[model samples]
Target: MSTSLSSDAAVTGTRVSPPSESRLRSNLVLVTLLTCQLMIVLDITVMNVALPRIQADLHFSATGLSWVMNAYTLVFGGLLLLGGRAGDLFGRRTLFIAGATLFTLASLAGGLAPSAAWLLAARVVQGIGGAMAGPSTLALLTTIFREPKARIRVLALFSGMSSAGFAIGLIVGGLLTEWLSWRSVLFINVPFGLLVVVLALRYLPRAERQSAHLDLPGAITATSGVAALVYGFISAASHGWGNATTDISLAAGAALILAFLAIESRSAQPLLPLHLFRDRNRATAYASMFLAPMAGMSMFFFLTQFLQDVLGLSALATGFAFLPTALLMFTMIRTIPRLLPRFGPKPLTMTGTASMVAGLILLTQLTDRSGYFPLLFIAMILMGFGIGLAVSPLNVIIMSNVEPHEAGAAGGALQTLQQTGASLGLAILVTIFGTTSRGAGGSVQHALVSGMTAAFAAAAGIAALTFVVAFIYRNPRPAN
Candidate 1:
C-alpha cells in the first residue's frame, strides 16, 4: 500500500528444456534487484523515526525538519517520468547502476553531514538517484523473465519488498537511532547500496540502448510539473491549503501537467504513452494503485502519531509495533502468484481491498483508552495482507503485455501516481486530523483520538474506492 517488480523462461514454438542453471542465475539476478529495491524503499522512511534526533543534533528548526523528507519526495517524484524514459532509451541497466552509485555516495555524504544544508543537498541527490533507478528496477526485472508466470512471481516479490520496506524502514530507523545515532540511518544505506552495485555488476546484463530522440521537452515538462505538484502537496501538508505557496505550486503543477499531457498526445516518442490507458483493466489497475496509497500512507502517518502521542509509546516500541503488519503482508505477497491462476487479479484485488477497508474500519474504533490490543493487532494484520494482495496484481496487469521498450515508462507512471497519492493523502489526512481535533470538545487525548479516528474513516473511504476500481476489472485471465 505504501506503493509499489518479474522473470525469464524462454517460450519456444516447441517445448524447450527448462534451464535449471538459467533459473538459478535468474534467481541470483533477482536477489540483486530486490536488494536494490529494498534499499530505495527503505530509505524513503528509514529516517522517519530518527527525525527528532536529527532535529536535535543538527539544530534544525521545527519548520525545517519537514524538509528532510520533502526534499527527497519532491525531486524523486518530479524526475520519475524523465528517469523512466531515459532508462528506456539509454539502457535500463546502465541507468540503474549510475543511479544506485550516486545514491550510495550521497548516503555517505549525508551520513557525514555537519550541517542541515549539507544533509538536505544529499537528500536531493538521493532522490535523483532513486528516480533514475526506481523505474528500471521493475523494467529490468520484466526483461530478465520473459515467461509470464515467472514474471508474475518475481513481481510479487518485488512488490512485497516495497510494502514491507516502508514498515521495515521504521524499525531499522528506530534501532539505529536508539542503539547508535541518527547518523546510522543514513550510514546504513552505504553498505546496502554498495552490495547492490557489486552484485548488479556481476549479474545484470547491459541493455542495448534504443535509437530515439531524448524527448527533451517531455522531460522538461514532466520533471517540472511533477516536481511542482509534489512541492504543492508538501506545502499543503506543512502550511495548509490556503497558503499562497501551496496555491501557486498546486496551480503551476496542474498547468504543467496539462501541458505535459498535451505534448504526450501529439509526440511520436512520448515519455508516457497515451495508449496505455486504452485498456480498461490497465487503467483501473493504475487507479487502484493511486488510491491504495492514499489509504496506506495516511494510516502510517496517523498511526505513528497515535502510537506516540496518544498511547505514549517509545520510538523503538512504536517501530516494533508495525512488525505484525509487515510480516503478514510479506507472507501474503509471496503466495499471491499461486492465487493468480485460480482466482485471477479481479478477485484478489477486490478481496485485498475489502480486507484493507475492514482493517481501516477497525482502526476507526481506536480511542484514548485503547492500547496495542487484539483490535489494533488484527487491524494491522488485515491492512498488511490486504495491501500485499492488492498491489501485486495491479503491477502484473500494468507490466503485462507491455512492449519491452516501454516497460520503464510504465513503471515510471505507476510509481509517479503512487508517490503523488502518498503525498496528497498525507496532506489531506493531516488536514482532516487538524480540523477534527480543533473542533472536538474533549480532553487532549480524546481530541487526538477523535482526529485520528476521523482520518481513519477517511482512509477507509479512500480504500473502498480501490474496491470500486477493482470491481471494474473484467479480464478473467492475466494479461501476457
Candidate 2:
C-alpha cells in the first residue's frame, strides 16, 4: 500500500526549526534512537535464548519453532526499502514515532499471545515496525549532524550498537528468561518504546521534502521475492533440500527475484535504485557486508546452544561468556576514527575480516570437552575485534558516498542485505547442523562442530575475496 502524502508535501508540511540549545533534549533524542536500534537488533538473538521456553509454553514443534525468528526477519528484511522510502516521503520524525507506537503495541500483544499462531503474527507485526524505524535512525542522524568528524563519531557508535546489540541481547534475554519468564522478553519493550515515542515527537527535526514517489511494483515484487527466498531456505532446514515443497519454494522465489530486477530496470522510481551499485567500492562493500555477517550470525545462534547444552553453563553464565567479545567491540569502536585516518578503510576491513575468519576457524576445533578459558573466550574475543574493526568502517564507507537525500534509501538497502545474509546464513548452517546431528545419533556437540567448521571455512574464503575487493576502492582514506 502506498502512503498518500507526496515528498514535497512532507518537506513543506513540516518546517525546520532553529537548532535547540537543550543538550539534555538532544541527548534524549540520541538515547531514544539508540534504544530503538538496540530493540531491533536484540530481537534477533534474544528470542534464541528463550526458544526452548517458548516451545514449551506454546507447544511448538521443532519445525514450527524456527518460525518465531523467520517470521520477524522475513517481514523486516522484505519491507525495509519501502519503509525507508516512506520515511523520506513522509516526515521521518512522524514515521519514527508511528513505528515506535506500533512496535510497543505489538510487543504487548506478543507477550499476551495465547497460541503459537498469535505469537508468530505479533512477531511479523513487530518486524513491520522495525522496518519503519530502523532506517530512519541512521538517516535522521545524518541530517541532524552534518559535520564530518561529528558524524563519523555518531555513526561509529551507531554501527557499534548494531553489531554489539546482538551479543547484549543474548545476555539480557538469558537473565530475563532465568529470573522472570520468557514472556518478559516481549513485555520489556513497552516502557522503553513508549519513552522513545515521546522523545522523538519533541526533539527530532523535520527536513524539507523532495517530490518523491513510491515505487509500488518494486515494493511488492521485492518484498515477495525476498520473503519467498527466505521461506525456501527456512523450509529446507527442516524438510531437507530435496523435498518437493522446498524445490517449488526456491524456484518460485528465484523467479520473483528475477522479475523484481526487470521491474527495477524500467521503473520511474525504483525502491532500490540500480545505479547505487555502479560505484565499485560501494558494490564491494555491500558484498563483503553480506558475507561477513553470514558466519557471525550463525556463531551467535549455535554458540548460545553450546554454552547451555554442551558446556553445562547456567543462562546467566552463558551471557557473561560473551562479555569479552562485547567489551572488545566497544573499545574498538572508540578507536575507529583515529585508526581510519591513518590506516584507511581498505586495510582495516581486510584485517578485520581476516581476524574474524581466523577466529571462526579456530572455534570450529571446539569439542564438548573444550575449556571456556581458551577455546570459547579466546575465539570470541577475536571475533569481536574483527567485527568491531570491519562493521564501523564499512558503514562509514557506504554512507560517505551517498547524497544526503538518498541516505535513507541507502541505509535501508545496506541493512536489508545485511539482515538477509544473517537469515540466509542461519538457515543454511542450521540445516547442516540438523542433518549432521541426525546421522551422528543426535550428538549436539558433533553436530555443532561440523556446522561451525563449514561456516568458518566459508567465512575465511569470503574474507579472502573481500581483501581483493577492498583493493578496488579508489580512495581508501576518509574525507577530512
Candidate 3:
C-alpha cells in the first residue's frame, strides 16, 4: 500500500519521483488519476440527462427533481476543502481509495433506490465521497510527476479529461437514459470506480502522513458558510432573491465566511491557508478558475434547456450537440503544453478568456430561428477551446508557487472555488433567464430564447472580468 519512490532518478529533489517504470508506469499513473477524476466530473452532468426519468419514476414534483442534482453539488462543493486537507494530513492514496470505494457504493445505492428520499440520500453520500477523493487526484499527480516536461504533458491530459468529462457525461447519460433505464446512469459508476480503486491500490504511490491536526473550527465554519451560500444562490432561482429564506441564508452564509476567515488566520493548521492567496499568480489562477467554470457550467445548464425546449431536440441529440465543444477542448489541451513555453500563462489565459468572451457574446445573439450549424456549433467550439487553454495553464500556474507539501490543500482550494463558482453562476443566470422569459410573455420558444440570450450576455461579462484578471497576473520568480 505504501511505496517509496525516492529511488527513481526521474523523481528527485524535495519531491519523491517514481522508479523508472518509464512510459508504462507513467501511463498507469495518468490513467488511474484521470479515471478517478472522470468519475467525479462526469457524475455532475450524467444525472442531468436522466432527471426526467428520475422524476417520473419517483413521482417527484418538478421543483423536487432539481434537488436530485443540487443535493450532490451542494454537498460536494461544500466539503471539498475538508477532503483536500484530510488527504494532506492523512495520505492521498489512502483517501483516494476510501473515496473511490465510497463513491462506488453510493452509486450502487442510488441505482437501486426505491424512492425519492433514498436516491437523494444516496446522492448526498456520493457528494461526500467525491469531495474526499477529488482533490487528491491532482495532488497525487503533482507528487508523482515532478519533471516539468513530463508534468506539463500529464497536466494537459488531466485538464482535458476534466473539461471533456462533463460533455462526455451528457452523452453517456443520454445513451443510458434512452437505451437502458435511468438507473443505469448511476450504475455506470460502479465499474469505473472499481477500476480506479484497483489501479490506485496497485500503482499509486503512498505519501507519509503529516502530524498536523485538522482545523476543526475552520472546517466547520468554512463548510457551513459555503454550503449556506451555495444553497441561497440555488434557491434564488426558485424563490426570488427577496424571499425571506434566501435573504436569511445569504446573510448567514456571509457571516459564517467572515468567521471562517478569522478562524483560518489564527488556526495553527488552517483548513485553507490564507498565505496561499498571497502569491499573485496563484490568486489570479484561483479567480480565473472560478470565473471560467462559472460561465462554462452555466452554459451547460441553459444550453441543455434551450436545445431541448426551443429547438425540440431529444436528450440524446442534445448531448451530441456538445460534441464539437468537447472535441475542440481535447484537441486544444494536447496543444497547450507545447504552447506554454512559448507564451507563458498570461498570453494563454488572456487569449483563452478572450475566446470564451467572444463565444459567449456570439451565443447572446441566439434567437429561436438560429440554426445549430454555424452559430451554436462555432460558439461551443470557441468556448471549449477557451476553457482548455485557460484552465489547464491556470492550474499549472496555481501549483507553480505551491510547495510539494501544500499540493493537496492548493488543489482542494482550486476545485472548491471552481465548483462553488459553477453553482453560484448557474443559479444567478437561471434567475435572470427565468425573469426575462417570464417578463416577455411571448411564445415559450421566444421567451426561452430571450432568457438564454440574457444569461449568455451576463456570462460574457463575467468572462471579460476574468480576462482582466489574467492580463494583470504576473508571476515573479521567488528569490532563491
Candidate 4:
C-alpha cells in the first residue's frame, strides 16, 4: 500500500498531488509529530532549573514563582478541548502549523521578557499554542498509522519521547542557565518549533474538518474553572487555606466545573463526548493519567528545591540529578508494547502505580544527612521506570478504540487531564510545602526540607489512588 496520505486540497491556491509510494515519508510523518509532542511536553519543565534565576532577575516572589509553571499549564489544560475540536472542525494540519508558528513567536517573546508580568503573558500565549497543537499531534498519528502493530510501536515511541522531554528539559535548562542564561531555555524552542512547522507543511497529510462546531462556552467554563482552582490553591500557599479569597475562588471553581459538566451533557455536540466515558479501559486510563502526573510533576518541583536548597547542589547538578529517571523512563517505555499484549494494561498499570507510590514514600523519608545514592537515586529510578510502564500503555489504551472522528477530542481530553493534573498537583503540593515550612524553626534549610517531605507524603497518597484505579479493570481488554 502507498504510505503517503491524501493529496493536498490546495497550496498557494494550486492543487498538489500526493507523493509517490515511500515508507520513509510515512516514517517522517511519525517523527515530525513525535517531535512536536516532545517540544510541548519539554516546555512544562524546561524552565524549572532556572526558576531561582528567573525569580531573582524578574523580581518574582517565592510563592509567585510557581505561577511560572501554573500559568502555562492553566491555559494549556483549559483550552485543549476547544483546540482539539477546532482541529476536527477545521483541519489538523492547518492548526498544527498555525500553533507551531504561534508557539515559536511566544517563545521568542518569553526569552526577551523584561519583567515577571511580561514573561507570564508570554507563557499564557505559549500555552494557547500548546493547546492548539498538542491534541492534533496525536490525531494525526491515528490518521497516518492505521495498522495496529505499527500504531502501537509509534505510540510507544511518542509516549517515551514525551516522558523524556520533561527530564531532558531539566538537564538542558540547567546547563543553559548555568553556562549561559535562563533565557536560553525559551530560545531553544524557536528552532525546533520552526522545523516542525516546515516539515509538517511539506510532509504531513491534511484531514477534512468534521461537521462539528467548536464549544466556545464549554471552553470558557473549563478554562476559567481550572485557572480559578489553581489560583485558589496557590493563594492558599501564601494566605493560608482559610483565607476568604481562597474559599471564594474554590467555591466558584467547583460551581463552574459543575456547570461545565451540565453543559457537556446537554450540548448537541459536546466538547467532550459523553459516550467516551462509558468505556471502562479508556476511563481507567484517563483517571490514572490525571493522578499519575500529579506525583510525577511534584517530583520535579520539590526535588529541584531539595537538591539545590538542602544538598547545596547547583542548578546544573540538580538538573543532572534527574537524568537517571529520564534514562530509565526512556529505556522502560520501549518494552511496554511487547509486555502490554501479554499481561494487559491492568497488571502494567497496577505495578507501575505501585512502584510510583513506593518511590514517593521513599522520598518522604529524606533527611538532611541522607545520601543521594541510597535515598534520592533509588526513588528516582523507581519513579522513572514506573512512569515509563504506566504512561505509554495508558496512551495506547485511551487512543486505541477511539473513532477517527473523535480522535482529536479524545487526545484533547487525555492531555487536558495530564496538564491539569500537573498544574493543580503542583499547586496543592506547593501549598503543603509552604504550610509545613512556615512552622519549622528559623533555619531555611529545615523549613524547606520539612515542606518537601510533607509534599512527597501527600504525593504518595495521590499516586496510591492510581493503583486502586488500575485495579478497577478487573479483566484486561485487548489493546485493539
Best by TM-score: 1
Clashing pairs in 4: none
User: In candidate 4, what are the lDDT values of residues 360-464, reduced to their tens digit?
Assistant: 999999876676887899999999988888787887888877888888889888887887677668768878888888888867787788888999999999988
User: Residue by residue across 82-166, what tens digits does model 2's lDDT show?
Assistant: 7877787776788888888898899999999999999999999999999999988877766665557666766777888899998
TM-score of each: 0.95, 0.92, 0.94, 0.93
TM-score (C-alpha, index-matched) for candidate 2: 0.92
Cα error, candidate 4, residue 205 (Å)? 0.2
Model 3 clashing residue pairs (backbone)? 11-17
Runs off by more than 4 Å, candidate 2: 1-22, 441-444
Give candidate 1's error at residue 213 in angstroms: 1.1
**Which residue window of length 10 is worst by lDDT in model 3?**
1-10
RMSD of each: 3.7, 4.6, 3.4, 3.0
- What would the TM-score be for candidate 4 when compared with the true structure? 0.93
Residue 259 error for model 1, in Å? 0.5
Error of 1 at 37 (Å): 0.9
> Tens digits of per-residue lDDT for model 1 on 41-83?
8888888888989999899999999999989989989988899
Q: What is the lDDT of candidate 4?
A: 0.83
User: In model 2, how large is the Cα lDDT of residue 57?
Assistant: 95
lDDT of each: 0.86, 0.78, 0.85, 0.83
